[model samples]
Target: MTQRKRMMRVPAFPNNAKLFALAVVLALFLAPAPARADVTKTNVGGTDLQANVQLVEYETSCRTTESDSDLIQGIIMPRNPASVRSVYFYFPGNTSEDAAVHEGGSDPERVCNPNTDGKTQFCKIVNNNQQFAVVTFNRNDAHTNTDNWLDEASDIQCFLREARTKIQAYNMNPSELFVSGHSGGGKQVAWAVANGGVGFSKTIFWDACYGTQCSSTAPRDNAGQMYLYYRAGTDTQADAEKAKQENSLKTKLVETTLRHPAIPNGCFLDPSNNDLCGGRGEEKGELVVGTVEPPFPLGLVFDETQLIIQQPQPRITIPGLQFSDPEELRQLIVREPDGSVYIQIPFLGQYLAAVYQWAVAAAGIIAVLVLIFSGVQWMMPGNVITNILTKAGGERQEESQNKAKKRIAGALIGLVLAVGSYVILYSINPDLVEFKSLRIPYIIPKPLVETDEPVDSIPFSALPAGAPDPALLPTAADVCFPLTRDSLDPRRGISWNWGSHRDGSDSDACEADSDRCHAGIDIYSKFPGQVVAVADGIVKDIRHVSRCADGWGAEGAERPGDGIVIYHRSLGLTFNYAEVDEGTSRVQEGQEVRKGDILGVASYCGMLHFEVYQGEVDRFQTLNWCPPGGIDVTERHQCATQNYPRPDALANPNDVVRRLEGNFCR
Candidate 1:
């Protein structure tokens, strides 16, 4: 472990600070390498993105012993002083390297920290002495003997401790931390959000969903702190469609913030049928924000400075785009790749067998007690053993029977207690639960799934020719939102996106994009107060989105997918959230908002939908917060916000607004 600890540290010259400075100087003064850590640097940026960039690294203990100089790595990307009121951590995708990691089983060897080996991964730290910090440590565990490859959430917690230690020495506030991740990395974010402890408040998901990693028993985040996103697009027929899906997701999540739900902002997904997440990648930026128009933020630019320091992009001829569609571009050739499926088979079987054996052992113990009872009962003729009991006087035979019965009862009680103790112990420590669900039942040893039958069971058999044709789809619990005004709780307003399939409301019930009816509604102040407090007093803890609709317009709506939140005094009351078809905006803390005031419009899956919190909080059984009729619950739909546009790009802000006026579903 000690040796592993040393491996986790970032490598440096004689002086850590000076060496880092020198490394920065080298990158600033020279060319970037094609790869990293064969020395301690990464080639950052590409033809795709650019921005102010810096790469910093941090680590934790490896499992290897102290004496050995060998070890594995831990990675990090932190926002120096946080910004955008949140943070994101992208997870590495499934690749040849991951395939190799899996091939090694659960015990994938931990590598030396990249910084130590002279390799670099980019880390962005803001120079401000801000009070909050966003740490992104996506667990890179691919191999190991553990049940699940544990992401370093606990380790990250420990790292936060270290950060706090630094803060104490430097006399800074212990800042709040938020975590975000994509793909499998999203799973790590989910775990951290649920268990990341106090410093961590919410999560951002990219190209992922709860799936099984999010346990059913797990509590749902009600404050709207938890957000999920997925995006996909089409081909020549639909280059713009990709942008819509991404916009839609961001819109939905952003909208959720109004109701003060746990989710902060929906994910930004430029829809593409590409693969997995449909080509959501950029070499840079906190949010890959840019106007489809002009004066794009520098954050939109991909920083190549790091690359210039190492391997400069070669003038090598690149292959032409071969994909016919976004979907085609994303196809992966999935080979078993020398890795095991049902990898925990052996271990799981042992656990089951152990459990069964233990049960049988208990049964045997019960049987022994029964035998003793039987022997006592059978000693009817006053055998010496029996007489010893009946001795003094003519002890009643019935008394002997009663005595035997009591003994049996006592034995059963003891057995029950013993078993109970074992259960308690197992609960406290999972090591005691010796059972595993490693393999699917009837899994073929050298297995394969038959494709002849067609995997989608019903497939999209009777579908329209070009689009998804609305033919297929199958697919949370503890969740909340914001109330911006003194008007009635927005949550009591219209429920967005509660389509016929998922929430059981018909699509017709949803206002069409062409329809001017604000799809979501505004819950008016029941008592008409300027500052209507949420039903509860804890409203202070919530995080909220602060964008005006006019500023958001279509592009912001399509891009950010971000939302905001405000806590309530009551447990269940909430406001309405309707995503805008606009651009993302910046919001500051403690800004005063009015009752029935427009918070920010959300950019949800192509519509302005709203969810409500009127009934019980069961994940499956509640109604949406959308108000009656097609009226936007915001009371007056266009009353609250103005749209904001990205500075650069060819788009005319006026045109975007004009299109959104009609297209704005909310």
Candidate 2:
């Protein structure tokens, strides 16, 4: 070994070279290997796609149990991180079990691999369109209760933040962001846009939007493009139409013949095909889709029609020039190359009006200031210092005094003119001082008073041929009583008589011109109970009348409460069921009801101010005369015009009461 070493040691290696060799050997043996990215083979509509999936964890309060940690998992498939152009977040529909324990286990492969035909289309669309997809899992327990995604808006925001971070880790800087949901997931998508503030330019709802959130302008204003997809004839369709009506500029309703669960399959299979997935799929409404400039120039084009400004053109009037319509004004404002007018400033009239007002106010202020200065000069004719400086007295001082007197008189005249002009203009017409164009007052002609035409009252003969037997309970023949017999017992202080008013005043006598006469009968109960509809009718109106304070039917202690008015088209009469609890109203305006249907619970005041009108009369005619009852000035005015005991159509309800008491045979 000594001989071999001597032979090889002809040259010596440097210290640096020896160190480099040793480091290489150590690194090869001790260094850890690079980790492999998670890759999954997703079968999307018969096509196997290889995608780099990541399991991202985020903090959220949306959980099945309070003891459960805030941690939640989301699935992200960044097909090609370097080439990602957009990020599409998908919220799956409600599950029968907690999303983590569903059929696909915690892996969420049902949404990732997209086990369903409809879900597979989403994956395929994302994979083929250079778009990264993210799927969020919800903590819904079928056996317990399904949670609303809208209720946990904060959770949605947290998930989005974490998902974006995960995408960035793959070196993706997507220029566009998108959100989509199915069924309950649709609510999630809406909440994200409404409250998440995640800068999603495009949003889609699939068979969702059954609530008022989508109909709101906030989401539509936030998203650059919004598509509401619904199965034909579903509530979702109706809501989508409402959203379209509210935000016609941004919202586009896409109706499909496919079932709710299968909508994604049909719509996502080809998003660009208007006849297949777009609004034209079912050909229900007009859906205009074309390229247009975005609100801001970001070098990106959108697949939406240009916003057509439908604002009415401003009215322009000039002393010398008269323009017939807005087109003529536009032609006058903008000039052609040959010097003909062409362009228009829509706000010209408003601008000029504002300027005129400012000028008038400024002139008025200057006149008052001049008047004050003149008054001060006239009171202090000449001070000692002024006399010494002028070195004049007697005749000269008198001349100066006279000059000041003249100036004061002139200033007074100017002030009077300025102040009087405003007063005169205001007296002539309040609108003149308002600086607005004069408008002819529209006067509603007074109706002719007919002395011979008598008010129609429900006759006693109108009741079934028998006396009201209190012993007999209301039957099917009676349809329904205003108050159940149990709640209308005589011992409970309620009676079949109609003489006293709700205010405990006599309501028997009526004067033609008196507005204080009671227009309805007051029925009181000892305890609050169900108030049923007496006859099948359509609800005409509802009102908040008075609330209970110290106790039921207490004097001078009631608050604002609720009432309902129903129009019995068959009977050609309106039934005013007043003083019901607002929180308990079971019917809405225009809703049709059958006899015996519970209208609502009586107020805690235990009073039902029941009125029967001979014909269809809304709250204006029926409730206006009552204090603290009219909703608007028009209704209040009607109270003065149509005095109480409404002479034209008021009816006595004794016969009606008999019929409601089961006295009617048919």
Candidate 3:
């Protein structure tokens, strides 16, 4: 489709002296005077239409910190503030380094002094023939794009507060606000509506409504109306079509979305392949005329003579509707806990799957035939009957019958055992066979195969019901010590000075600066052996954390290093060990471990920092515990001793060391 050509006449403004005088007159009689707005026609960004640019002073609540600036300069268009019935707000795409972080240009100013080089998506939107008062904002990078501020509810409130005042000032209805954007800006618009409490009357997108995230089939609070103008053959179209596939949850979801009832006339706009609809035209920048009907209703009257310009392609909208986020679309794809994604099979696939049941029936018939043949041979008097009929064949027939009867009997027994084994084993643990669905048509090609990655099998049920008997404990020759290749005592290069960095420290020995101090000991092994779990437990977590020694390497110099934490539910304790050699962890998280099982090698700094906490592992916080001091926090865990209670307060490991003495070489 092509755009209708029209000669745009740039509005002329009065001289500076006359404008100054008019400003003074308005200030004295009307209301508090804000910066005077100006009307100027200029080429903005990459648009073919000469945009009538205007300016409005705006400020929002978003900032880097409480002390930072909140001022924003909004770029507007058409110059006439009074003629607009609807207010359209837009966010710009990714900004440059100079625009994202610097505060030099952040002061309040007239919005059209080209705060962003005048080359932005907002410029293209504001330049359109639409009569709505279009405005776009400028914020620092932290408040722009994916910094989370775009999704913040407070930021939206700030914008609406300022927008409402501006709309009222222009004698327009604030509630008639329409929000829209291009690309990243569109994402912000969707996120803002879903999370922010403000309800916009309408939303429009320009080749930006994307992914399941930007469009939704459900009604969002205060944001139930929307329109999408997208390019054909774009990723956005792919996502939309995917959502509309047969038997898809999104197909049903679209039905529930807000829609306009059947059109008064059966003719809806077709926006297919409207390239000239959204691009800079030929030399002299004149809009080319196209005869195609606009895909979406152009509610605004353009030049009383013409009703069309190149309109955007693939126009779609849910009428009387509000926009919703894609995340809100439930049942789009059902996921099982085992990490398999599934969808209800289409009718054809279901029928095909159901047809496989005949195979199972055929196998059952074979088993019955085998049983019948064996019974017939066993019941018949084969040798005696054959001898009466034919003397020569009696001996041979008897021998053949005996062998065949035995073979048939064995085959029948094997078939019974095979079927019985499957039933029994499946009843015991179903994970061995991962089925897609338990519904009818239960026979289907497997839906998906989780990676066949081989992993160690250590089921918790396989562990002894209680702690093993003393005789079952590993001897010195069977296991290596944590601090040494041999014994764990001081004479064998191990530390006996336990709790060196805990409560007794006078600030020098503590690794962490917090009041709790370091809750466990450090094992500095010169020739460290493989670090092993001291008891049956589950490997809870594996992380790479920075190793900071005192104040050195405390900044960015510190980096992620290997670490592991195991939870021993039987012992009511959790053990965290760090500084493991890279790529040496043989066990994965959630795997069960037996006593003295090698967890990983101790490498790099040769210093393994270990900490033990009581009770279940709190995945959120891994703070070390300390003895009850003069600290004001009442919930602080006391030192692991006889004086403190069990479970909440950690237990000392001096006794645990003694129990593992025999497992380490002396």
Candidate 4:
């Protein structure tokens, strides 16, 4: 806490000759007001509780200008200053030119101040009725104005601590706290509640709902509550959308404020309507906010006729301000019950166990009482004198019969009482009753029908007349044509010379005058087919077309579209294929694919961008076939045409296709 010097009051001289006296009076009025604290203690007229109204004036360290003091003047009414269970601090909406500390901000006629008029709506609805205290503070030295109270949040926390310390002197439950505000003040209340780190019990917003963090904040604990009430007619489409998103954080419903049947006061328009409230219950024990958007001035009220309706838990709408008449705002706050009170009942086994225990205990007590009564009857026999003259044998016989009858009756009565007690205990808590030796049966399921059979291989006899010989390839049995038979026909389709080409460039390596290197052959077909896997391999990587759509290369470089990399572990080689139609990459990353399996359908980019790499090739950086030294076009073409070792070239994708019969032309 920052220390402040107190200015002492000096006596004024009336004599004109005393020039020093006039100077002192002028300085007091012109200079900044001294920091001070004052308290007014009064007794509530009809109640035992006492009200201690306090005024604390302090200068905040935050300042942007040389003339800015950033002084905060606050008025606090922890209604019963001492022993408060909770506190509600309200931040007002409007602004004023001069400081509110020196000049009272509220108009005597418009704003309610219980100190001046005890009959004010604020006093009736809040201070006088609720057990918690209420405090109203300004953002700075000036009148309440901007909703940017978040700027002074740290300073406000310091002030709150001092207030808590003062109230702690008289209150036992000083930890319980709450925050509220209307309009701009409400935004401040939200920032304080969400980011302030204080464990507030509840927060009430009246005709104010706007906060950057409002969409993410939630109640701190099970007992914490948040209520957002605003006029619907005054809300814009954007405001409604923002409100919906914020309320969704706590899974609440936002609806137009309507007059509910349960509220004693129907609609605000009706003359007889007094109070309105309503809320729907929730099952998860989470925060439930019932929003009603009524037009401004003639605002909405909640009609809370019943607390909880049916199944799940009850939706309880805590009391909120009626905006139709701002002066008619009512105070309604309902503290949530602790979560431990709701317990689920146990099933069959538990119920039977409780019953057995209860029965045993009841039977034991009843048997003991019966034995005591029998002993008393045996010791004190009636008609002592007349029995003594009669036969001793008849007395023993009569005693024995009575004893037997008492034993039977006591046993029967004990059984009945024990049975009745068990029944009652089971009804209350079925889980407590336990059944011995109970078994639950399990049902066995039947087998499922087999699905589609796997296609492992395609016969070479299906290839066209000019297809390359498969026997010359190293992995002849494993290789399969990449495209379907119909799309790879030799006569109608055109397969240009095998080479490399920088994508989207007009210079093709296959052309004589071109300077570019075209790494793969361009296969043009009017009717395309699904591109199958070259051999049995596992999918290594898959880059979808969405990546290229986001501009992968230089400014105007064409997108090679969706592509896949397959790793043939046995052959120690990798196959790269791209420019497949969207959603046609049948093989996913890490998927195992067999020969002749559909890898994807080649369609976009005019042709497929296919490449092959040897076991030691660096697929990512392998590009030019020519070395750094001077090399003619003939040598570069020779290196690209055949699969050979070089500084730039690793393997030719076209040569692999010819060697493995993947190419239609021999």
Q: How many residue pairs clash in each candidate at the backbone level?
A: 155, 8, 9, 41
lDDT head-to-head 1 vs 3, winner: 3
What lDDT is reached at residue 276 by model 1?
A: 18
Candidate 4 C-alpha error for residue 614, in Å? 32
Model 2 stretches with alpha carbons more than 4 Å out: 1-72, 76-78, 97-107, 118-121, 139-143, 148-153, 217-219, 269-275, 278-280, 283-666
Per-candidate TM-scores read: 0.27, 0.35, 0.28, 0.30
lDDT of each: 0.30, 0.51, 0.41, 0.41
For residues 5-35, write the lDDT of model 3, one tens digit per residue.
1111211111232343334334433534374
lDDT of 1 by residue, 484-577 (tens): 2221122233222111112213234344421222222222221111122212222121232223322223343533333333332232322323
For all predictions, the C-alpha RMSD in Å is 28.3, 29.4, 33.6, 29.2
Error of 1 at 374 (Å): 15
Which residue pairs collide in model 2, if any? 334-341, 334-342, 334-343, 335-342, 545-561, 546-561, 547-559, 547-560
On lDDT, the candidate that comes out on top is 2
Model 1 gets an lDDT of 0.30
Q: Of the candidates shown, which would achieve the greatest TM-score relative to the real structure?
A: 2
What lDDT tens digits, residue by residue, belong to model 4 across residues 404-523?
Answer: 346645654564565556578789986454343223221212223221222122223432122223443445565766665434433323243333233322322223333334444444
Off by over 4 Å in 1: 1-177, 187-413, 416-666
Query: Looking at model 3, which ten-residue stretch has the lowest summed lDDT?
Result: 261-270
Q: Which residue pairs show backbone clashes in model 3?
A: 3-288, 3-310, 100-141, 223-322, 223-323, 224-321, 224-322, 225-321, 225-322
